[model samples]
Target chain A: MSIPLTLVLGGARSGKSRYAEGLVTAGPAPWVYVATAQAFDDEMVARIARHRADRADGWQTVEAPLDLAGALDAAPAGATVLVDCLTLWLTNLMLGEHGITAAIEALEAALDRRAAPVVLVANEVGLGIVPDNALARAFRDEAGRLNQRLAARAGRVLFLAAGLPLTLK
Target chain B: MSIPLTLVLGGARSGKSRYAEGLVTAGPAPWVYVATAQAFDDEMVARIARHRADRADGWQTVEAPLDLAGALDAAPAGATVLVDCLTLWLTNLMLGEHGITAAIEALEAALDRRAAPVVLVANEVGLGIVPDNALARAFRDEAGRLNQRLAARAGRVLFLAAGLPLTLK
Candidate 1:
């Protein structure tokens, strides 16, 4: 079967990450954890450690704070690749002045070429009050657009909250 | 004068989080950091820790992975408050059988009651490929609708990438 891509999305602390981990653990083939976070300080270092401790011993971890497509290229075929989160990755790209259109194309191309199942993690940001500042409001708009693009490509979608998972794909 | 509500948005690692923190640090009152992340494992713990270390001293931190409205309500009026991100929060609400309409209403109401300048962080997810799954497609659609609604009401909008901020509101 062609690789299936699942998108896991939720608010912070809504159990999206946990749910995504479970899905990979239960699925077939070699499991790989593709982490998008960079350790900028002590708090992040500890957070990364905790995540490492939580994963199964067999799971291989790949730290790709910005170059996701390149990271995916390095993953073996027939493996199960779980991207810890896409939001952080996107943030990295956006801040670098990388073309959003090109970055997205690279990700999709990699996904299409990969033979393993891909699960992407993301956050949903539009269900809140309108922001009053220009910068904040613009970000909300862009995030909404990006989420739409990723979700459209995902084969399955799940929303998590309170450690609960709901299938939306 | 009413307290201004700011929406901060960017792709992952775009320095939006740090930027948000800077905005709050510049505020006149003691700032509050409303965290929405949950530690299900070591990785998340490290992520949270990194965020904590990034903050300056004397900032009150509140961990509310869910129940954002309640957290907002609990914050003292006239105190500068920062919601680390909204995408996760929305996913939290949506995963628990919460309809988009209700969630938006609740957020709007809570925002109306706030007396301090509130800075909200969110990730941009719409600038990518169309998902193949129904659930992800639905999320994308809903997020878009929600962002549009919020943007209509927000006083300011900004897009950040590579730590650079662009005004759009």
Candidate 2:
């Protein structure tokens, strides 16, 4: 079967991650977890620690704050690679010297070249009042664009809310 | 000329709102800013105040934390409607009894039925490390999926980073 590309999305407090984890558990092969977060503060540090404790010991955790393309490349073929989230990855790229276009292009290329199933998680942030600040508004705009590109490439799309999964594509 | 549907995306401080305002400033009226956030706390109250103070007198603001389809129906046919962000809207839906699927379907129908040019802003949250907590992971997953569905419907997609926009579609 052709490798399936799954994109999971939801708002805060939604149960998308657990559902995705369940999918990974049921799937085959060497499981790889691609993480994109950088603990910048105490709260984030604690958050990271909590996530680390939740995973199964068998899964190989790859800390990839940025350059997900490279991380995907290094994973062995036939492995189920789960990129925990895309929003943070985009944040790292936006904060980095390399532009957003280049980062997205690289990610798309990596997804296309991969032979294994890839499950990517991201946040839904576009359903609110327009921010008054310049910086907040810009982030929202870019994220909306990035999500569109990734969604178009994904074969399966799911939205989770209140711990429920609703398959969209 | 046909009105263009614009997608604005960003993170917490990525400047997505201000950029969208700039776009509106250059476009035709009657311009409507659809506010999808609810003030549930002191921090949110302050954030909302900050956003309100940033707008020009020419823009008319409409507060609709839920029932976005109804809100869209109230907008003028030829006017420009800017749905500030999608994250908060999803949050509102999750907090409600209708759940994710119904909310998504309603929003999709609204987008399809609307005649006005709609500019949507959202946050991209899938880049970081997998959250150790089940709740955080679930939120990340659902947000990613919602973003994908909306992005697929948007005509133009833009990714913002460090206040810069990279057009992807």
Candidate 3:
């Protein structure tokens, strides 16, 4: 059977990530987690550690700070794979000075080739006032574009608010 | 007939304000625009000006920098009242050493007393990585709480993404 893809979108503390994790864990065992976050600071390190502690044993974690497409290709077939977030992956790519256009194309291709069910988490960052800085504005615009693209490709999309899930697709 | 209260939420540049304006304009001839923004910078001045220019005549604008409840109470009955935002008013209250708890209480009370059809706009800012600063984190938390309260009280809540409105209530 073809694996269905789902996208979970929410603001910070909206429980989107938890919801996505629940979806993957509900379907199969020995899940593969594609972690895109990089611990660049103390807070992030603690956050990452907390997430690690939250998951039960039986899950294999891949540190895909970049090369997300490759990480997807590496996952075992018929296994449930969860990409913790796409925004952090985008941030990593931007900070690393990678070709964002080519990276997005590759990531889309990877999603198209996946044999296992996949759940992706992304932040909904475009719903606020325009940031004062040009960099922040650009990032917000880029994130919106990326989300639109991903939402279009996914079989289902869910938006989280106040820790509640509202299916969008 | 009781006037409808609409809560319009979206990310930056998501056309949320425009959408809210459309809602008010669609209902009545004369409109009460309850603007919560304080133009503290040139960019903001330009933004406010742009919004002003975008509207046709017959809009009576109320500059509610801190006294939002009073402004709302003063709006004409049987007219459309659009509160451009709540987050900025919260920021103003926080910065001006005003009591947030009391302000929220007053705002809620005012919403309860409105005699006109009201459409409120607010930014959804709780999504994304946690802010590094304590002040920012506090602000995000407060925004989230305030949004939940207002959303629960609102007759209808709409989340805007990619310029599309998805009704949540």
Candidate 4:
């Protein structure tokens, strides 16, 4: 069967993760949750715990902070896979001083070869004032470019706001 | 005839301002540009100057850092008014220790009573990760709420991305 790829975009606390979870849960069991966030600080630890509590059983969690494309390649065929976010993955790459273009190219290639349906969540962060710092501005620009690329490739694209989803493509 | 109100929302450099200008210029000649930005830094001064140069002739510019409602009220009847942004105005009010709730109420009241058609441009800033600082978190929360309120009142609401307009309402 041809694998379906979906991209979900939203702002902070826009209920995008929950909405993406709903989409995957409605399709198949034995879901794989590819968590891209790392526990760098106490606040992140708490946030991660909250996300963990929000998910029910039947989810196989994989901690793929950097090797997202590899994780997708290893997932079982026909079982739905969800990458909780792309922005966090981007953050991990930037802080790790990894080449962003190469990583994104690998991710796109992996998505192309994946056998199972994959849903990706990302933040829409460029719609605000330019960040006061150069690092932040660069990150926002990268996020915007990344989102555009994913949205173009995904079979479905959604923008979430206030817990509601608007189909973009 | 009753006044028409439009709200154009987008991310940083998403061409929202240019799109908003097109909407106004399509209707009439004498356009009022309500700039809510305060040129505090060199970067901002340059940005403001760029925006000024981008605008065409037959434009009346009003600098309203904090008193947006007053500026709207003082605009000539039956003319077109474009409020460049709301987020900057909100920031001004917050830093100035102005009452947010009262000010929003006054702005909404003014919008309702204005005789001129008003087009507003605002940034959608809540679609990213939770801000690390309390002040930034507060600003994002306030921006989200303000966008919701304005969208509710707007006769036409649009979400712009990649220089394209998506009619939200």
Q: Kindly provide the TM-score of model 2 when superposed on the true structure, using C-alpha atoms.
A: 0.53
What local distance difference test score does each model get? 0.75, 0.77, 0.84, 0.87
Ranking by lDDT: 4, 3, 2, 1
For B20-60, candidate 4 gives per-residue lDDT tens digits of 99999999767899999999988678879988999988899
Q: Give one digit per residue, the lDDT tens place, for model 2 in A1-169.
A: 3558988876665766667777787887589999898998998899878887977777899999888999999999889899978888877877775588887888888888888899998776654444446666667667766766676677887777788866655
Per-candidate clashes come to: 67, 71, 9, 8
Q: Which runs in model 3 stand beyond 4 Å of their true positions?
A: A1-8, A13-157, A162-165, B1-3
Docking class of 3: incorrect
Model 1, which residues run further than 4 Å from truth?
Answer: B1-169
lDDT at residue B154 of model 4 (Cα atoms): 87
lDDT of 4 by residue, A8-126 (tens): 88888999999999999998687999999999999999999999999978899999999998998888877799998999999999999999999999998888888778999998789
DockQ of 2: 0.05
After superposition, candidate 2 runs with Cα above 4 Å error: B1-169
lDDT of 2 at A169: 59
**Distance (Å) between predicted and true CA of A110, model 4?**
0.6
Error of 2 at B93 (Å): 25
The candidate that achieves the highest lDDT relative to the unseen native structure: 4
- Candidate 4, superposed: residue stretches over 4 Å from native: A1-3, B1-8, B13-157, B161-165
DockQ, candidate no. 4: 0.18
Candidate 3 clash figure, as a count:
9
| TM-score pick, better of 2 and 3 | 3
**DockQ of each candidate, alpha-carbon based:** 0.02, 0.05, 0.19, 0.18
